[model samples]
Target: MNDQQLLRYSRHILLDPIGIEGQDRLLGSRALIVGAGGLGCPSALYLAAAGVGTLVIVDDDEVDMTNLQRQILHREQSVGRAKVDSARDALHDINPGTEVIALKQRLAGDALLEQVAAADVVLDCSDNFATRHAINRACVATRTPLVSGAAIRFDGQVAVFDSREPNAPCYHCLFPEGGESEEVRCAVMGVFAPLTGIIGTVQAAEALKILAQTGRTLAGRLLLLDALGMEWRSIALPRDPGCAVCGEGA
Candidate 1:
């Protein structure tokens, strides 16, 4: 690290756990964020501010006026602009040293696998089930750590799926792809704005922990939050042997 970098990340360096070594690891890591909306906004913000070496953000949607309520990375002027573009600009303004590769498109198939393979960690901040499952599959295939989060209607959840751990549960183990789970959109269900921030922040923390190799991540646990009731719950997650994505058959 240069003299300027040491001064810039002195706060992280001061920590006992995340001292200079951990901070250096963070400065050499790359993260792939799979969304640019509610959850993705705060996650990317912190990751960039914390001095992650590189960040690749993907999103096909454009920023809308409604997003201003919770998507902290975008402003009113960002409306009608591609979400990845808006996010890139904001992240650059926060930390110009962090490299931001903004891809204004949905990530899928081989492209998704390539990104997941290259990243030190993947943040699944996407809103839909299909995208979540796809991200999980790619992470599992690449053996990359994944920080997943979701928020809707005062409810939010976060989980870490680290395929590097033999017993760690992948996302598919918790929510099967073709199960009875229903897709709930914030546009339809009316999400609590701060709930997304809370969940997204947790996702960022887990990702940073994985990158810095400092603290124990939420690898075998699922965290659930009821923002309306101000309650939090932690559930032990077990890997499913029958999971299609990460099972023996897979």
Candidate 2:
């Protein structure tokens, strides 16, 4: 690292777990973040600030007044513009040294797979089941680490799925695809604003720990938060032997 780079990331280097070596590893990593809304915003911000070498953010939505409530990456000027572009601008402002690639479209199929394959870590900050399932599949196929998070109403959850680790459960292991999960949007149910920030930041923390290879990465655990009740809980997550995505059954 150059003198300026060292000074910029001195705080992270100060951590005994990170120090200079882990900071360098972080600077050599690539992270792909799906979604540019509430969760994606904070996740992208911290990853870039921590000097993740590259960040590719994907989203097809345009910023709106409603998003301004929790999507801290966008501004009044960003409304009506593609969310990925707005987030890229914010992340670049945070750390111009980090390369930010913004894809302003809903992604799937080979396009998503290619990006997932290239990334050292993938973060599922998207809000829907279909996208989440796709990300899980790609991560499992490529043996990449995934950090997933969700927040709606007063509830939030975060989990890490590292297929690189034996017995680690992918997202599909916990939530079956096309299951009974009713798509709940903040637009309809109303979400607590800080709830996204809390969950999003935790996702960022988990991703950094995985990149730095320090501490546990929440691979087999699920974290649940109830902002209304101010309570937090953790549930053990086990891989489903019958799970089609990560199961013994093909």
Candidate 3:
């Protein structure tokens, strides 16, 4: 770390658990964020601000006027631009030292797996079930750590699925692929603005912890937040040995 870097990240360096060593690890880590909307915005913001070395953000959508409500990375001028491009500009402005690889496309198949394999941590900030499952599969296949989060209406949830742990549960273990899991769109459901920020920030926190190897992450637990009621719940998630994605039968 250069003199400027040391000064820039002095706050993180001050934390006993995330002292110089953890800050250094964070400075050398690569994170793959799978969205550029509500959750992705804050997650990328914090990670880049914290000095994560590399951030690869993937998104195929363009910024819409509606997104300005909760997608903190975009401005009114960014409405017509691709979300990844807008996010790159915003992140660069905040921390020019952090390398941002903005891929304006929906990553799937080999492309997704390759990106996940190269990343130290993957943040599943996507909104849909299909994309979430795809990201989870790639992380599991590559044995990478995944920080997943979701928010809708007045509810939100966050969980970490670290395939490096033998007994840790993958996303598929909790929500099966073809189950009765319905796709709830924020556009249709009318999500609470701050709800997304809360969940996205938590996702960022978990991802940073994974990269720095600091305090215990939410690896085997699911965190649920009911913003309307101002209540929080932690649910223990168990690995499903029968899960097709990370199961003994496979």
lDDT tens string, model 1, 1-250? 9999999999999999999999999889999999999999999999999999999999999999999999999999989999999999999999999999999888899999999999999999998999999999999999999999999999999999999998789999999999999899999999999999999999999999999997889999999999999999999999999899998787
How accurate locally, in lDDT, is each candidate? Answer: 0.95, 0.93, 0.95
Task: Give the root-mean-square deviation of each candidate in angstroms.
Answer: 0.7, 0.8, 0.6
lDDT ranking from best candidate downward: 3, 1, 2
Q: What's the CA error at residue 82 for candidate 3, in Å?
A: 0.5
Q: Candidate 3: worst 10 consecutive residues by lDDT?
A: 241-250
Runs of candidate 3 exceeding 4 Å displacement: none
Order the numbered candidates by TM-score, best leading.
3, 1, 2
TM-score of model 2 (CA atoms): 0.98
Which ten residues in a row are the worst by lDDT in model 1? 241-250
User: What lDDT is reached at residue 183 by model 2?
Assistant: 87
- The list of candidate 2 runs beyond 4 A from truth reads none
Residue range 1-250, candidate 3, lDDT tens digits: 9999999999999999999999999999999999999999999999999999999999999999999999999999998999999999999999999999999999989999999999999999999999999999999999999999999999999999999997899999999999998889899998999999999999999999999999999999999999999899999999999999988885
